[model samples]
Target: METSFKIAFISGKLGDVDGVSLEVDKWIEVLTGAGHEVFTIAGLYTNPLQSISSDKQFSLEYLRFDSTLQHHYEKMMFPYLTKHPTHLTSGTRDIIVEEMMVHGKELSEDIFQIIQDNNIDVIIAQNTNAMPMTLLGGIAVYNLLSEYKVATIFHHHDFWWERSRFSQNRIEGLLNKIMPPSDIGSEHVVISSYSAHILSSIKRVIPTVIPNCENFGKAAVLDNYNSHFRSDLGFDKTDILFVQPTRIVPRKRIEDSVRLVGMYGRKYPEIKEKIKFIISLYQGDELDDSYIEVIKNLAKSEDVDLHLISDRVSSVRILNNNGERLYTSRDVLVNADLAIYMPKWEGFGNAFLEAVSCRVPVVVSTYLVYKTDIKSAGFDNLEVRDNYDDEGLLKIPESILIDMHQILNDSEKRIQMTDKNFEIGKREFGFKMLSEKLNTLLDSYSDEIRASRRRLQKSKKSYAV
Candidate 1:
């Protein structure tokens, strides 16, 4: 067997229910299984996400790039972003850049110290390079790449230009410069083909497209632990548990799910009575205020049993302070009759893949990534065309309601669809596929790391002299 490599993953915030954190966890698992030592640099890391041995605990503090982490300070500091790109004084803009540069240097120093302490061979930046949620952090990534001799994988989840939440104002210059600036030594990885095309067109840098994947090897079964979810959540055997396994954000088009349930109830009032819509993930909307409230009111108007169960769901399944067993997002998936992922936009379809893995029939809106990267994977689902006007309102499809009702009522159809989708999900997006891609990426690197270390030693000796 080959010797294991040391890989460090750097990110702004982790150990949460966000997609970037989830994907990074998958990468850590795969790399560790392949006998590589995995480590993290982030704003936060939960115990479940960290499996490193006690011996590898050196430089843990250095691993944290604290100031670079995302927080409420961001919207205030860069008010020009997400807003209408209002004009500020030249002094204010300059001060912002100056602060970023100073902080970027400090963060870069910590990264270098971590490399020196841990002898880290490769750096896998998790969603920090492209997105400017924290411009200082993004700039810090550039400084590290330029100043260090380490191998880097800029794993871009999404870019600033792709998101309306980013600024097109004064910081545009800074964003264009270091929000994943072109670096020759470092490798780039995009989650979808759409991003790959755009990166190439805009940045003139082509990258490997490794779609977000799941551990399809693990079968979701009715174990003693997870079997309690349906009853514990107060659902009788008769109630159809329809789950939306995504954050309650505006772009997710969660209103579509509520409206679908409403429309279903109007057609077959009896079936509607048994339908329960549970959003398994947390509510997340920094830009648009009170979308959750709107969703709740809409569900009320439509007379759908919509429950926001994010408080009940967590990244890990553990006992709560009240001695009750806390459930994860997976727990909800296993107990669900159907999953609906109707996002207007997505970096990639993670929740959709999860539904497929859990062997539940799913209904997905044709988000861009799903349309381009995943639709051809041959998974059977209640897929619908992206239905909505400019605003986030749902233009309800009457035809989908009929098919969805038919599918829900039939057990044989559920089995057939779920089995086929699971097989496809396992074949294309499994850990085996991810491992192969990672191995290929690792092979592309030279044995120059050893030589780079020797050069660093010489430079240090001269500096001391």
Candidate 2:
């Protein structure tokens, strides 16, 4: 008989445009399809889990990204890295930790109650276990894992060490201890080999690698509803749309995209006049906004028609106050001619795969993980060596420009390249790949799963009294 268990996906935030939130949905779908009852618990959920889950869902405001605990965490951690190391007094700093503990302990109790109430057999801390962005939520996870006997999986998408801003923080010790505990009861799942190596070297814990994936079965569409998206974004039907479909943050190296379009246009002025560089995502919770002005100025100097259309995109499709349709990134994607995915750093580029899924060619940068894991996937798309000089400028090769021009001018080249990349993407990075990895990982935990089932059985019997 096949094993089916009750699983809970816990995160600080879900049902949002963030990478962690987006990937969590994929995991839920795969697990649900595997005949397991799945649920979601987050601090915020604009769209609840019941929409996709077979089990009950829970959302606590404090577990969300903008929770009080997160604010306290920012207050406690940011000062050390900033010019204001003395921003908060010792007393004030102590008070912030106190608030985190107060809220964290409360969250722990709530989670414990939920587990007891529902008899959940497995817990999947989706990014919440590995990130200290939600200090209280991290603590709550650690506390629960330490005390409870439930089998847990830590889907660590990105670690604090990977980001520069998190380097010199006040809560390093606490972050190290609980952000991802050294517990033998839980298994760690990281997206990249680099992350798995870090976990091994630092925590002495091995991890399972499950690269982010897409549902290639659900084909992208260019329906009449989104037919006017080009016009809405001030682009003519004849214009070539070179889309930068990522959040407008520093690490995205969106400036490189501006440069790519600028140089491409400079080389081919006839098409430059017809090319529009569209950024189809929002400026996420970036610590600095100075990068925005820098990019805007750069785009102006290059004469690239850079359009920021984050306002028109959302996690769910809804109408604005003007009663206009709020289209998703998919809507923006199928209408695109090309995608620019030149992130200086990425946990993994969902948009890259989305572009591949939409049969759109993407100019993907060779970020470390892409080189370590994804580069050898035999994708037929533009490749830029992730090289930077002493001046911190991306050294994009001239060959990449020639290739882009060729693909843009020739429809056959675009179709053939996108088709080959889509086939490769579907073979290696699709849902079938994820489901197989997940099944094997879960099967390895057969002993613990059986043990967990017995524990729940005992608990249920006692509660009946």
Candidate 3:
């Protein structure tokens, strides 16, 4: 008989524009396309049911970041954010651990029930074991996996050690254990080679590296639905749209984009009014309102036309609750003239691939992962060194500004560059690669399952004798 497994994707939140959510969506597409039955279990759903049917979707309130218990625990764990206690007392720490165990046990039962009801063959835990955003969820998943023999793949995008905020946490032991259990009957998948190396060094486990990919076969195009994207965002046909297709976060280095745009405006005063640097996504993951304020202040000083259109963008194209026509990031990308992706750090650049898929030219920084994993792919981006000036702004080179001007004004040059990028992106980070990798994983999992079953049957016969 032909082999196919029913897979479940479990995460804190899915169906959103965040890197984890977006990448999970792509995996779901590939999995379902390959005739595998796929289901999603998330703490929250940011969009209406479209990818997965409502019946196949499961939502657990306790798994959400803003759940009563989660929020309380977060404040306690990262007390620097709350500004009350600098550290947790040993007694208080023990109490929190006890509570987590109790709550995790309850959550494990619920998750196991879902597995039993669905007959799920594989569970793809998306970032649940990597980040501490959903601590209890990670604990519960660990509990469930420890008690059961379910085939699992822990898809870790970012680890807790990578972020500074999670550094001074009170739950060190809990994080070391459940955040990513050292010994589990499952495979581990990291998005970049850097992550794989880090995991190997820290946890003594080798992981499969699966970089983020895009559907290059179906590239974004300016359709009737998305044609009005520019006008709706109050831009003219002649306007130069420089899109920062990422969240308003410090790590994204959005301030660099503002500074680059400011330089372009100063260099060419005639086209200054027509230049629009729009950030296409919302403030997400990292909570820093001060960073938004800093960007606004920097833009004002540089005389750059900055616009935040996240309110009108989502994972899917539909009317929001306010009846406003929402555009996906692709809608924003297809209409953009240039994309600014100057991140200080990234697990894997999803927005970079999105821009490449949309046939948009980009100005990218040479972050560590990009230097190691993505840059050698032979992409023709206007490269910026990941260096900072005394003013804490990303140093913009004169050549980058000149190249930006040429690409923006010269239509033939722009087309040639974007077309070349699209071909390279498709060749390197396409959906075909993802499909092939998934096939190999599934095949190995099937073999392992069969061997275990045979062992169980042999043991039963021996017991009877």
Candidate 4:
């Protein structure tokens, strides 16, 4: 009979710069604002918690990506990282599957305890069933949902099949069963229409599309604390700061950003020396240091002043143990002259929304989701074709370079373009839109629960007669 419900958000990691973490934060904000009790359960916490109380937060070590069980299964399933044999023997495969069941059961028990303690009414599994980053975690959630009648919503951002690295795995059977189990009595949510179409084709179940949203009401500005971001990051006052606010992952195609800057420098040699390309976020979710090296070498060859300042960036501003100031991602965006977001693929563009919300001009690649779901929103940005050259770098259009030059050099043009973009972005992807969609989804679930209870009562009375 209660109007509000206690909700629990479960994920592999939370309070970080990744798209999933940022989206989860926005969901928590909207849910709490709607008078619902929210709780967080994550395997790892990279940043401090802001919205959820400490008493309501739960951390499980076995569910972490770096846990011994996860590493063991990953190496066995996807053996590209290590020198181990690519194909597992049938007997060895069976043993690994048995171990998975054992560990998964333990994890499910632990998770159920938290659910019972908090009297949670719904569980929002954040990317757990979509990606195999934490294999046991996915199985555990599936098992928990199978044994109990706890309402759930699988908020899938990306699926394992989308990534080439997870394509040739030895655990196909297990992945098919629990990576995203179709039989679970829960709602499904995807970030884009493309993802929803794909999920329907694969799982035969239609998903509700919920595009990622931003808090446009509290736009970042050049405040007193963030005014010194440039000086603190060692950038000269006259330098043109072009920020790549994404992780150093392969799909991001950061080399393309470096190449664009290099081409822009050649076109206008006068300002080449004053250009600074800054990659604000850290390396990606996967284990790959060679890609960072590749970017560094390419930057050197292109003669770009590339700076990796992830050490001083966090979800929120704080001081490190060494007494150095750590700036939030908003601080990096507020001071940027232009944002370069040329990812080859993205579930949805969180960095794009962040830049637009901050009133910064963006140079975005026309990725699939961008073309399908976002471009029609009428945001004015310097667009790059997603086509690539034989060298595996994005093909930068000449017109993009010309537009970039104008936006970077002319103050009035920059202000007009960015202001227009901010209004369009806020109108399309603001918190109010998300809050409305979420409320509707929750209301439907509440109706289903009442219908289910009525059916149970009718069946019990007939059986007693």
Return the clash pairs for model 3, or none.
Answer: none
TM-score of each: 0.92, 0.94, 0.95, 0.95
lDDT (Cα atoms) of all candidates against the true structure: 0.76, 0.82, 0.87, 0.87
Ranking by lDDT: 4, 3, 2, 1
Which regions of candidate 3 fall more than 4 Å away from where they truly are? 449-465
Name the candidate that leads on lDDT. Answer: 4
Considering summed lDDT, which 10 consecutive residues are worst modelled in model 4? 451-460
Report the lDDT tens digits of candidate 1 across residue range 392-412: 576667888878888887889
Cα lDDT of candidate 4 equals: 0.87
Per-residue alpha-carbon lDDT of model 4 for 270-309, expressed as tens digits? 9999999999999858757999999999999999999999
Residue-level lDDT for 215 in candidate 4:
95
Clashes of 3: 0
Native-structure RMSD, model 4: 3.5
**TM-score of candidate 1 versus the correct structure, residues matched by position:** 0.92
Please list all clashing residue pairs in model 1, or write none if there are none.
Answer: none
lDDT of each residue in 129-195, candidate 3, tens digit only: 9998888789878876676555678999999988888877888888898778777567889999999
Q: Tell me which of candidates 2 and 3 scores higher on TM-score.
A: 3
The candidate with the higher lDDT, 3 or 4, is 4
Task: Please give the lDDT score for candidate 3.
Answer: 0.87
